[model samples]
Target: MAERPRTLYDKIWDDHLVHEQEDGACLIYIDRHLVHEVTSPQAFEGLRVSGRKVRSPERTLAVVDHNVPTTDRSKPIEDPESKAQVEQLAINAAEFGVEYYNEHDARQGVVHIVGPEQGFTLPGSTIVCGDSHTSTHGAFGALAHGIGTSEVEHVLATQTLIQKKAANMLVRVDGRLAEGATAKDIILAIIGEIGTAGGTGHVIEYAGEAIRDLSIEGRMTVCNMSIEGGARAGLVAPDEKTYAYLRGRPKAPQGEMFDAACRYWDSLRSDEGAHYDRIITLDAASLPPTLTWGTSPEDVAPITGAVPTPDSVANPAKRAAIARALDYMGLKGGEKLTDIAIDRVFIGSCTNGRIEDLRAAAAMIAGKKVSERVNAMVVPGSGLVKAQAEAEGLDKIFLAAGFEWREPGCSMCLAMNPDRLAPGERCASTSNRNFEGRQGYKGRTHLVSPAMAAAAAIAGHFVDVRSWR
Candidate 1:
């Protein structure tokens, strides 16, 4: 006789369910589809071979990011493979009649960034891309995650995804964050506690006072790394801040329509009595400026801590993994994190390339020079973010601080483009993932927040950002 209580994930899931099978597989409509160069070529080709037109061309948007050069766009792309992928995306987009933003378009950026910037990612929508970081869109209370190339083709042809429901997990962070601690630190801290497989088969909904306090951009940073934590997706309930962030964007509903949308978004939260499959809580104030000393996101320690020894892990397999990671990272057991030097600093990716990230890094490096021993660069998440940073003079501050101001793209986040590390070159990176060869062949990556990456650029090693002047 009573309405059933449901989690945010359940609410969105039920809203999008089109058909359910006996084994629990469902056909769920995809509201927003973000496309990039690397993964969609095959999907697009599948459509061509089958003579399948995109069911909802207007709902799909494509852009070039992963394979675009972060350097001079005035010149033609030099790498043959990169050139082909970029060109093919343009061709595919034209043939399919899907809206596209090319390398030179002002709207061009990492698909994850462009989606939210243009208001294409909306609360209560089901968004998908072929890239792992598609989880980033969940920041707006959407049910979003990455899909495979086959799934991409399926969505392009049908505007629906085959899916199974994921259990709901809650990651609640209480108390205010410490000074110099950021949303990046919060997420890295979470991965440290949960390990890589912690959120397997679940969707994590981040709640509590600390999560509420984060700006939408910060929330995006957290959700962007949900893949690193093994979560199917991550979500935060829509609130006034979420509504405010979407209000003036181009694709968002405007004026009275926006007011009506807000009314629906307001109910996007979990009911008071909803249950979670698992719950994890953290004391935000206790989190320090954290960094990953090994190859995995979970191999994290506070900046003030030391590299963990293999023996510190009780499980033999985990201990062996720790040893392998430390060896790959060029870190010795018990070495202080601050004592490890870095040769490069990368301050961009879908993870930490927003305008706010740029502003934070710029504020930290203002009137200060990057260490002569370290080569550093800043790549904005999108061309729009680049323009915004320049408008606010953040670009000048970074240039004056001796950090290269790179064009927008997924620069140095992976080895896809020209921005990469030489073998054995250690880097302090703001991007997500530090897996073997993530940045380049045998490159060593230490993941940090934008400010911490900037600080490392200046100090040439990890430092307690909380103590930075």
Candidate 2:
């Protein structure tokens, strides 16, 4: 008999597994629990009603992001409901004695962005948040996912979650990405190929040359969108690049501890010949700058492609979905994507609001002015990212090009605050989703890369950046 080979997910799961139950479920310890305003209020209320204290308050971190206005943070929040939610989170954090980052805190930002920036997200850790995009932390080889409010309360009281293991999925992207293609393009292409439900009930491990070659920020962008592809979570194996990014971070381990942690992280990869329930391979070089033409993220095509005709699809369900999406997006079959004009351009979100993303957009629109008819804005992912961008003069480049440089806080990504699309308005956005009414009621969205969005802002239409350049 021989020991069975294991995947990166298996290794991390085993390390954190506290107990196995007869019902085929296991109790896994959570190393980090990141909370935000939108999801934590109810959970805290549950704790108050039950007379329970957080089991490991020190392990949990709280921030106000969702529903917080991205503009003029210094003033009172305008929306009453939004203000209440933000205020309640601050009160709850104070009551629980948990670490909190409010709008005024220098460390304040989206939980996903703040976690990695603060080094609270480390390799081989089990992280949970009330956010679906908590999978973003998986970029460091961690096992992370979103949980419901009840599950949030459970984790808060017990510091562990009971769950069944997800099936293993390997997504390999070999070959170098094309010059104009980015990690956003690569993930969008993967979703487009597999459809939104392709990785359902699975934990996806993104590997191969293309993934390995991406910068840590790029890897984060890919893993951040795994949920959109219907994966339980997504991860990249920790390596030198992961270590370099973690080194010298505020909460990261110190010298000798970091070295030891690296040793463990080195063993976090899948063993050679390990079995996966399913596998997908992509040729990275063949991918173009992808954009969603319909409602779903999978309803995407290259910038040079056109809207797909539902009539051309053979499957009734898929055809119906395509038709419905096309109706919602106000698109007709066979219309060239480049010919579709946009009313606005938004280049910020958890998906693409980091400094690298800002730089990428700035480089594309450096000397080009935005179309007068198009309202374009650039929002950074976090206050830190904002300060960094300003230091590098990226803000000036964007302002000079007619793009409004605004504050950070998931702006226009969900339209929770004032940043939203007017009814019937169409936008080229860097956000992950393109669901109907995602940006606003009856608003149409076309998801694209930061550079593609910037290019669209300038051209006032969807043009292939490869050609625009």
* Top TM-score prediction, candidate number: 1
List, residue by residue over 353-431, the lDDT tens digit for candidate 2.
Answer: 9999999999899889999889999988989999999999999999999999988788799978889999889999999
C-alpha local distance difference test of each model: 0.95, 0.92
Least accurate stretch of 10 residues (summed lDDT) in model 1? 324-333
Query: Candidate 2 — worst ten consecutive residues by lDDT sum?
Result: 65-74
Clash count, one per candidate: 0, 0
Q: Which segments of model 2 are wrong by more than 4 Å?
A: none
> In lDDT terms, how accurate is model 1?
0.95
Q: Give the TM-score of candidate 2.
A: 0.99
Listing every candidate in turn, what is its Cα RMSD in Å to the true structure after a full C-alpha superposition?
A: 0.7, 0.9
lDDT of 2: 0.92
Could you give candidate 1's per-residue lDDT for residues 224-291 as a string of tens digits?
99989999999999999999999999999999999999999999999998999999999999999999
Error of 2 at 235 (Å): 0.8
TM-score of each: 0.99, 0.99
